[model samples]
Target: MTDLSKRRLKTWIRLLGVTRGAENHLRDYLRRAHGTTLPRFDVMAALWRRRDGVTMSELSRLLLVSNGNATAVVDRLEADGLVRREAEDGDRRRIRVRLTPEGLEAFEIMALGHEAEVDAILSRLSETDLEALRDILSRAGRPE
Candidate 1:
């Protein structure tokens, strides 16, 4: 590879490693402390942010996950009585997933916990370094 190409590849690999470690640690924390998984929490967060509820397609898109994966998370949430899946009013073929009262309560707790955990993790870096890293990652999809 060219010098630039090798550097870019190395950057990608390092970013992936850091992200994987962060995700694994957060997932384990949630499972042990909240009895929840990352995917389920992500779904709940998406639904919580939207008052109108969300379709499975939308959830898949927002979560950057597969349709089957979103469906499985919804199934587990429904089984736990935290979320309810219903047919859309205008289109019976389309289903919407909404959090039940219990789900909202659980999500509130999880959200707060997650925010603190994320803050703690990011707090290791100085503000300027954090901003620089954010700037670099924000340009990830831009044309070089």
Candidate 2:
């Protein structure tokens, strides 16, 4: 492999390792601190970030999960009173999901704990490094 190929491969390896570690840390923290699983927290976090309700398709895309999986997760959230589903008056087939007030409160609590955990994990990195990491990952959202 060329030097550039080797560098890219090494970067991938580092990224995968770091991602797995971070995922585990977050999962363990959420479970112990909030009694929630990572997937449940992810769905709530996505909705918490959006003040306006999102469609099922949009949530599925944002979460990178299948539509059926999104539907099932949303169902559980709704049953827990953390989320509500509303049908569009003009389009009965369209459903929108929004976080309930209680959901917002719960998310805020979880988010505070999550941020603290992130800070502890990322304490070795300077603010500039964090910004660079954010910029690099933001590129993943770009279309091909």
Candidate 3:
């Protein structure tokens, strides 16, 4: 490989490492502090974003996870009365998932902690450092 190619590969590896490390920390934080798995939290977050609710397939797509994985998490949430599944008027196969009042309350609490935890984790970076990182990520095709 050319010298430039080798440097690019190393940069990619470092970026992946940082991303995974941050994700791992979040996973652990969610599990230990909120008594929730990352998958469960993600499902709640997506639903929270779309208050009207989303079809099962849409939920899976939003989370970028397989239907089976999303189903497992949704099943658990349903059992806990955190989510309710409703069949679409004209389509039995398309079920909409919505957060219950209790679920909303729970997610709100978890979200507060999650936000604070993230802020703490990223607090290591100065404002300038954060701006630089965002610029680099934007240039690398990351959405704003």
Candidate 4:
């Protein structure tokens, strides 16, 4: 392989390793500290962002998860009184899920800890390093 090709392959591996490591750490921290799974937190985060609520299909699409997967999480959240599912006005078959007031409060608490955890995890990187890495990733993600 050409030198450029070889270097690109190594870079991809390093990127994947870093991504997986960070994800695993976050998952573990959430489970241990919050008594919640990453998927549950993700669902809450999505609902928190859309105060007006979102359809089940929209939630699935936003999370890039299957309908069944999103439904299961929503079901649990509803059971815990963290979220509510209301039938759409014009469409009986459609249900919009949203965080309840209690859910919003709960998520706010979790969000604070979540931010602190992330900051601690990435604390090794200086501000300049973070900016540089963010710039590189932003450029890499953009379509040519």
Candidate 5:
């Protein structure tokens, strides 16, 4: 039992370190290559997925962030003409936000770069290694 616990502890630490390292690298890559922050990129990605738009609260929930954090990023995007907010028909207080055409174009470009950056970071891993890691993660929990 102690041996199993030790092994699991080591595995968890290694997994966490690698995840954090990759995330940090992507964050820096986005900032330097696209002049965008990770939070902004995340918000744009979520909006891109939901073309019809989502309420501000929904966006916050999707991003797993506080409303203030989500709103601040949205505020900046709106000022840049990258996003537009519209009030719901029946409930004026429920503002739905979506990417403008320009925002879509911008996010598409950034997403391509983001993919490339991730690929580069993980290039050392063989296809078999990646597949095995994916399987393990899938078994562990969420599928994201």
Candidate 6:
């Protein structure tokens, strides 16, 4: 009921709207330009960062997704020859998933376009505005 409470509520709604809008735009761009879903791109991006590969558990943890979800994506990527799952040397029950050479090349191509798409989407924000927004968000996201 207080003025401060109303202002905070409005700010929260605006923030959510902006975040969803950006996400939707990126999703559309990826689907239209690359014929890929956001989740697939995210999995590839994570694998690209870790050339040595990661365990299925680790991949799920890294992406904050469920093991089954990560496994499904990995399964598809492996089928496409973009990734390989190898049994761990010491642990037969455990497996590590890594991007294949072809996967790396494919991800590189996608990464370039992804960067450009993001740039285009945020083109309206000036450098100064971006820096300011980043600072504000960083502070807000941190625990008090």
Full-model lDDT, candidate 5: 0.94
Off by over 4 Å in 4: 142-144
Each prediction's Cα lDDT score? 0.92, 0.90, 0.93, 0.93, 0.94, 0.92
lDDT of 2: 0.90
Give the per-residue lDDT digits (tens) of candidate 5, residues 6-45: 9978998998999999999999999999899999999999
lDDT of 3 at 133: 93
TM-score for all models, in order of appearance: 0.91, 0.87, 0.92, 0.93, 0.92, 0.93
**What residue pairs clash in candidate 4, if any at all?**
none
Which portions of model 2 show Cα errors greater than 4 Å? 132-144
Candidate 1, residues 1-144, lDDT tens digits: the string is 899989999988998998898899899989999998999999999999986899999999999999999999999999999999889987888999999999999999999999988888788899899899889888786775
Q: Candidate 1: minimum summed lDDT over ten consecutive residues — where?
A: 135-144
Could you give candidate 3's per-residue lDDT for residues 113-137 as a string of tens digits? Answer: 9999889879999999999999987
Q: Candidate 1: which stretches are off by over 4 Å?
A: none
Cα-lDDT of candidate 4: 0.93
Best-matching candidate per TM-score: 4
125, model 4: CA deviation in Å? 1.4
Listed per candidate, the RMSD to the true structure in angstroms reads: 1.5, 2.5, 2.5, 1.4, 2.5, 1.4
* Residue 56, model 4: Cα distance from true site in angstroms: 0.8
Q: Can you give the lDDT of residue 30 in candidate 3?
A: 91
Report how far off residue 8 is in candidate 4 (Å).
1.2
Best of the two (3, 5) by lDDT:
5
The alpha-carbon lDDT assigned to residue 81 of candidate 4 equals 96
In model 3, which runs have C-alpha deviations exceeding 4 angstroms?
141-144
Error of 4 at 103 (Å): 1.1
